[model samples]
Structures are given as C-alpha cells and as structure tokens.
Target: MSLILEEISVKREHSFRSKIDVLPHIEVPWHYHPEYELIFIEKSHGTLVVGDCIDHFNDGDMIFIGPNTPHIMKNDDLFYSKESEERVIAWVVHFKEDSFGKEFFLLPEMKRIKEMLINSFKGIRIDGSTKYKIIQLLQNLHNSDYSQRIIILLQILQLIAQSEDLEYLASDSFVESFKQSSNQKLYKIYEYVSENFQQKIDLDEAAKVANMSKTAFCRFFKSKTQKTFSEFLNEMRINYAQKLLAEGKLTVAQIAYECGFNSPSYFNKQFKANTGKTPLQKKEHSY
Candidate 1:
C-alpha cells in the first residue's frame, strides 16, 4: 500500500462530475486529493480513517473532507457475510476552491460558504436536521441540469456553513502533508491494532509489523502521525468504547472489558479524561 496524492484539476471549464460509487467492499487505500469532497455512505459500516483521526462509522454517515486530507474507509467483518458482501453505496461531490473563481467566495453572499470551507480543514461530520437537508440536496444535484446542479451545490454549502452541530474529526496537527510513502507498514499496524485493541499490544510486536526496531518505529510513527503509538492505540480503544456505550446494551463494566481495558476503574478515569463525562453520565446524555 502506498499513499497517492490524487491529481485533480480546478478549472471550472473542466468541471469534475459527482460520482456514485458502489463498492463491493470498502477498501479504499489511504490517499488524498486536491478537491473538497462531500461523501455520504448509504450502506455498510466500518472504521473510517480521516487524516490522523480513527473512528467507526455506520450507514448514513456524512463527512465533508477538505482538499489533500488523507482518508480511507475499511469494512469490518460483520459487514461481510456469506449471503453477500456488504454494499457500500456512496455519493461523492468533488470540487476545487476556484471552481467558481477566486473572487466568487469573497462576495457578501458567499461569506458563509467561505467560512464553511475554512472550517472543513478540520474535517466536518454533518449531523441531525442539517444532514437530511444536505442529503436531499445531493440527490437533487444528481438529477438536475448543470446550472441547477451548481445552484444546489452552493445551497448545500450554505446549509453546512450555518450548521452548529457539525462534529470535527481531525486534529489540527494532522493537516495535509502531501507526501508519498509506502503505506503497507501503517496499514498493517492499523489493522493489527483495530483487531486486537482490546488486548495488550507491546512495542516489540508492533515494531516487528513495521519491520523496524522498537526505538526506530517509535520515532517514525510519531513523526508521521504526530502522536505516540500508545496514545494512538488508547484513542482507538476509547473510540470503540464510545460506540459500545452508545448502543445502550451493555453496562459500563461490560463495555470496559469488551473494549480491552484491564480495569473498569481505569476505564472510567480515561473515559472522563477524554470525553469530560462519566459512562453513566454520557449514557444519560445520549438518551
């Protein structure tokens, strides 16, 4: 696996068309492009890697990725079965900053849209009422003429700009690097960690996966991700814990053990530190 920066032209006369991809399996290799992308996952559930953030995503998840942000969506085992491989129907709208011209966004009418694009560098996940509206707009765009399509796109951007519940995914440090490198090592590392995050992952074992000495791997991983390997693993485990907790089918203790935390008390402590809420508190809030 290698990270490839997808080349995209920004000229309006060479407009990039919206694409509807029906992937048999969600296995996009980690890559990025110079186009702002709005993606809606119609089906399939899996782990989503956006920039340096790692989280699980389910059907109907909608994300707006800024230009040059590395990302991928990997299907989990539950999403594939003997009956059929899970279907991933995604609608992607890609456009460049100058698609409407450099001076377009500077107009008073486009202020909100400009702000939305600026905030998208952090990777926004549209949710609630706004999400439904955007989905509808995307559908209309798919069926409309070129002029109508452009109008719809602008409307969608305006909606996102006004949305207050948009969730940020990537950290500031994970901004675009636009560097190409063999992604095999990072992919293997993430796969191993995702599969066994509930158990202990020693530095020696993880280093071997990358074919580097423990010390060397530590430095390399940190330099690439801007996060210590342990920090990344812990965050991954915590992200799983959040999903499990959200389901409301398990007790906090059960979720702690299920997520691979050695002790329930430690799990509670970390959860609070990461989310600023206790397990029960979060559960109540969710309800």
Candidate 2:
C-alpha cells in the first residue's frame, strides 16, 4: 500500500502523542510521520517493515523511528483469521523534533542526546538492559505528573543514547519519501519476501512481482535497499534463523534446512558472516 502521511500531535499541550492500542489487529496502513516515535509492542506477533528493512517482531519489542520513515506492523496470518483469538497490544509515544525546544537540545549537556536523535532516522531497536529500564520508564510516563513525565521521557532518551544495545533498521539505503505507485509495488515485493523467504525463491519470481525484468529488478532493489535481491533474501533468512536460534527449539541442522539453507555448513558460514556468531553460539548466548 501507499505510504500515508500520519499526523500525531497532542492537543493543548504542544508536546507529543502517547497512547495505547489494543485490538484484534494493528489497523494502520503503511504510514510515515514528521514526528519521532517510540513504541513498545506488549503483545503481538508480526512482520515489521520499516523503510527498506523487513523483520519479525513480537511482544516486548521496542523501537524508535525517526521522522518521515515509512513503517507498518503487519500481523501474522493467524490474526487475520476470524476464528483466531490473537490480539494486538502496544504502547506508543510520538514527539516532534522541536518538541523539547531547539535551544534545549543545542546545549552542550544535550550533545549525546542530540546525536542519538539524529541517528534515529535509520530506525533503532532498543535492546539489552536499556530496554528493561525503558519499559519501566515508559510505564511510569503513563501515570506521572506532566512535568515528571517529561523528565522521565528525557531519562528514557538518555538511556537509549548512552546504551550500546541498539539495532539500526535501515542502515544502508532508505526511501526518504514514498512514491505512491512505486511504494505499492515495493510493498508487494516486501510481502512476498516476508511470506516466502523460507522457500526457494528465484530473482525471476521477485522481478515478476515487482513488474521489472530480472536485471532491472536487480537495479531497482539495489537502488531501494543497497542490497542485491539475493543478499536481501539471505539477510531475511538469517534474521529468521536468529530467532530460531534464540528460541533453542531446533538443532542447528534443523534450523538450517527450515530456514532454506541447503546445509548446516553453509548456514554456519552465513550466520557467522552476518551476526558474528555461529548457531550454537547464538543459542548459548540466548540463554
């Protein structure tokens, strides 16, 4: 779908937007905004598409997205089933670039926070001990006095700024603004990759879905993501494989085959190249 411009301003406060969404599914379409957003998904299982990155997300996942980045949390197929009882629950806060006053952020003491803000354009995943602190602070934000709430918000930002546990979503290339027609086609390609990355997918199939010749698809995909089609596919697979490794639910060999790798040896090689860890090591670290 086309990326729609979403307005997220809070009335009377000249501050930000903070609220919770609890529903059978995430109803928002692929959208972008001028405000930075901090979100905590308390319940849900889905594929998250942010800029040119496609990845899986689940409960307790928190993310920070910068202005004008298109993103959407697409629910798993089960959520769309009428008979399924799965529900989506999330807490979100949206703030403007100048909401803290431009001068305040320019002060010497705010340098680190300012740098973190600038880096958020690529989209950041808050992880490690900082995530736990953020979770507590975010809950506090809901009940604190207005002034205290702002203080806690700054603390959360500081935590994110100072912590080393962060993951960038769109590191290499990004679509700064959506092209109505092209974004729709890109979404189809994204959806296809998300649904079928565990299977053998040829560049020809992806090219047909994107309405481009195989060679043209290579150029188009690279222009959008700075990664070849195969690279993107392998990245997606590795991401999924990381999830499986963390779960400790399958052997390395089983995970390799399940994630579409031809063999465990190749899987181990790719896993180390992409994540700096072997399957067994990741599984151990997860515990």
Candidate 3:
C-alpha cells in the first residue's frame, strides 16, 4: 500500500540472503533496497512493475534488479480468491554490491560480471534457455552447502552475463516511479508518453511536459537516460503492443493503429525489432 524498505533476511555468517516463497499473492508494498536481487518465478502470472517498465510475468520468469530499484509483483485478482488453486511461487537472492569484496569486481577476470552488475541498474529479464538454466540453479541452492551456494550463485551470474537473451526493462527512462522521488519530472514525461502513445505526439508537446524547449528537452533527456526521446517513445509503444498481443483481443492491424503506428507492417517491423518476435509469432507462443 506504501513504499517501504524491505529487510531481506541475511544470516550473520553470510553476505547474501536467499529465500524461496510460495504465497497466495505477493502482498508487499512497492519498495526499494540496497541490494542486487536475482529472482525466479517458478509459478505465477501477474503484472510486474520494475522501475518505469510495466509488463506481465509468469512461470519460468527471471530478472536481476540492482540496488535502489523499486519493484513489486501484483498478481491478478484470481490469485487472491479463496477458491482459486493458483499460487505465487518464487526464489530470490539478495546481496549488496560489495558482498564479495569491494575490489573483487575490479579484477580482470570479473570484467564481464562487473559490467553485467552495472546493467542490472536497469533490471534485466532473462529468457530462452538461459531462463530455464537459471531457474534450475536457484531451485537447487537449498541442497548445496554454503561453499557450493556461493559457487552456484556466481555461476548463475556468469551465465546471465554471457547470455544474449537478456532484455533490460528500463533502459530508456529515468523514473523511480514507485518511490515518487524527485525524479518526478521524468516520470511525468514517461507517464504522458505511455498514456498517449496511441496518438501522434508532437515533440513540442512532449517538451512541454518537461517544461523545456524541444531541443533542450531532447538534450536533457538523452543526457540523463542515455536514450533519445524518439527511442524511448518507440520503446513504450512497442511494449504496449506486446501487452495487446498477449491479450488476444485485437487483430494485428487494429493493434497497430491502437499503438499509434500508421500501418500494420511498420508496427510489425518495430515489434520484431524491440521484442525479437513478430506479432503473429508472439500470439502463437502465448497460447
């Protein structure tokens, strides 16, 4: 109901904490913390909010979130019903940036892991065979001893770092949306675009949301988020299209118009570019 700091359980002898949870629903309020999180959802289907990125998640879903990122998994209403048989099943690991040694990531051998850790700032979703493997490692951790626990954890990180199936959830925006922090300016702009993505948004109108000149807003946004305004807007539209695709309620052409694309073919091309799959392919996979 409110944004709060979550205290992930950590034993005095260990620098990292791991827990496997099965819940009627994930009832935590929106929150953030000072630890990197590796999460695997074994069984659940719900809306997941990460930074400013909103999307659906299900069984076999996995993501890595960096410190200070706000997130929550809000299961669908059915999961809360007393007669429902569904459950929220997940495993999560939390460790601080310097959990190993402050200088450990500085070593040459740890370069890739170090970069992957940095990328976690945007929240990375793992898919394809990599998700399957990471889920396996997380599930088997309970059977291993402390030493193996560390080894397997590192292996998981290494595998994710090397994977091409990783998708960043917030690479384009700068909103700590859940916390309602001072980053509200960017959040406002992001919200505006998300809600109006189905219409032809004027650049001047977008800049007005940021209270800056069009050129100035472009410079400021790119400087802060490393993505141009156009790029971020397209990302938002494509994400919305993905949601529509999963709903199975609209034809591809209808969805294309609903998402503000001028034509279905152009929308399909962008969808493939953003998600690595065409609309028809995603629809087929969804069922």
lDDT of each: 0.79, 0.82, 0.81
Instruction: For residues 62-169, write the lDDT of model 3, one tens digit per residue.
Output: 989988776777888899899999888889899887888889878999899999998787789999999888878887876676688889899998999899999898
Residue-level lDDT of model 2, residues 1-287, one tens digit each, is 44578877686853777788899988788778889999999999888877656667989899999887777888889999999899888989998878878688899998999999988877899888999999899888887766887898899999999999999986444434233234666667776776577778988999999899998988877776667888777887887787778778899999999888888899899889988988898999999
Clashes of each: 0, 0, 0
1-287: candidate 1 lDDT, tens digit per residue:
45667765544543656867897776567777778999998887888777656677889999999876767778887656667656889998999888778788899998888888986876898999999999899889878876787888888998999898699887654453224334567756765675567787888999998899999999988877777998777777777777777778899999898878889999998889878999889988877
> What is the Cα-based lDDT of residue 71 in candidate 1?
77
**Per-candidate TM-score against the hidden true structure:** 0.78, 0.77, 0.70
- Candidate 3, residue 213: lDDT: 94
Please give the ranking of all candidate structures by TM-score, highest first, separated by commas. Answer: 1, 2, 3
Model 2, residue 241: distance off in Å is 1.4
Superior candidate under lDDT, 1 versus 3: 3
